[model samples]
Target: MEPDVLGLVAGALTTIAFVPQVLRILRTRSAHDISWLLFGILAVGSAMWLWYGVRVNSLPLVVTNVITLTLQLSIFGLKWRYGRGKRP
Candidate 1:
């Protein structure tokens, strides 16, 4: 496989890895076990990576980070909604 193809595969895998957690949280309407701080940091980091990818003109990085950012933001929203009153 070509390098771009390999990158695309890896990007897709990493990008989609957050989907299960998102779906679980949405279905359960519970984010008590999820770490809000961690997800917050991840979202920020992913955003920065996406900006960097744009600057570097890397399609795989841009695409993957955009997807990851969206998923991470969704989790953040769930965390705020369902994890606010819960204590770890």
Candidate 2:
């Protein structure tokens, strides 16, 4: 298999992995168990990955990191909105 193909597959899988969590949060309307630190780190990391992808000119990294960052930011926002007054 080609490297781009492999990267696309891997990126798709990892990006898709966040879907369930987002859906679950939406369904449950609860994010008390989510961690602010973790998602904060993830958001930063994803942003860095996105930047790296842009620098390297890798479509897979760019696309996937964009998506991953979006999802992570969504989760982070949800965590903040839903976790208000809740424990970590």
Candidate 3:
């Protein structure tokens, strides 16, 4: 496949991969097993990717990282709210 098409497909798959987890968390209303550190690092890394994408003018990277960052931040917020209690 062409590079742009490949990038978009890859981006779409990776971007949507977080959906199930987000939906699960929302349905369960619990993020007890979620790792804050992991999500924090991911959010930061996604932000960096977004910045790099802008600098490099890669549309795939920009769009992918934007959506990824949004999802990661949402998970982060959910974790913060639902993970407040002790882990069991």
Candidate 4:
């Protein structure tokens, strides 16, 4: 298979992986179990990956990292806002 194809496949899988967590958080309006350590690492890592993707001009990497970054930031925010407080 082509390298780009592989990258796209990998990117798609990883990017979509965040969907469930995000959805659950949104649905339940709770993030009690979510940790800052996990989301923090992910946010920073995704930002770095996004930079790397831009530097290397990899479309799959750039697209997925951008999306992943957004999702991660949202989760981070949710973690801070709802992870500790009682559910509403």
Better of 1 and 2 by lDDT: 2
Query: Sort by TM-score, best first: what order?
Result: 2, 3, 1, 4
Number of clashing pairs per prediction, in order: 0, 0, 0, 0
Expressed as tens digits, the lDDT of each residue in 1-88 for candidate 4 is: 8988999899989899999999999998789888788889989999999999999999989988999999999898878877775445
Query: Using Cα atoms with residue i matched to residue i, what is each candidate's TM-score against the true structure?
Result: 0.88, 0.91, 0.91, 0.86
CA-lDDT, candidates in order:
0.87, 0.91, 0.90, 0.89
Off by over 4 Å in 2: none
Deviating ranges (above 4 Å) for candidate 3? none
| Candidate 3 lDDT by residue in tens digits, 22-47 | 99999998998988888889889999
**Which sequence of candidate numbers ranks them by lDDT, best first?**
2, 3, 4, 1
lDDT value for model 1: 0.87
Regions of candidate 1 where Cα sits further than 4 Å from its true position: none
Per-residue accuracy of model 1 over 1-88 as CA lDDT, tens digit each: 9877887899998888799999999898888889877888988999999999999888888888989998998888888888776565
TM-score of 3: 0.91
Worst 10 residues of 1 by lDDT: 79-88
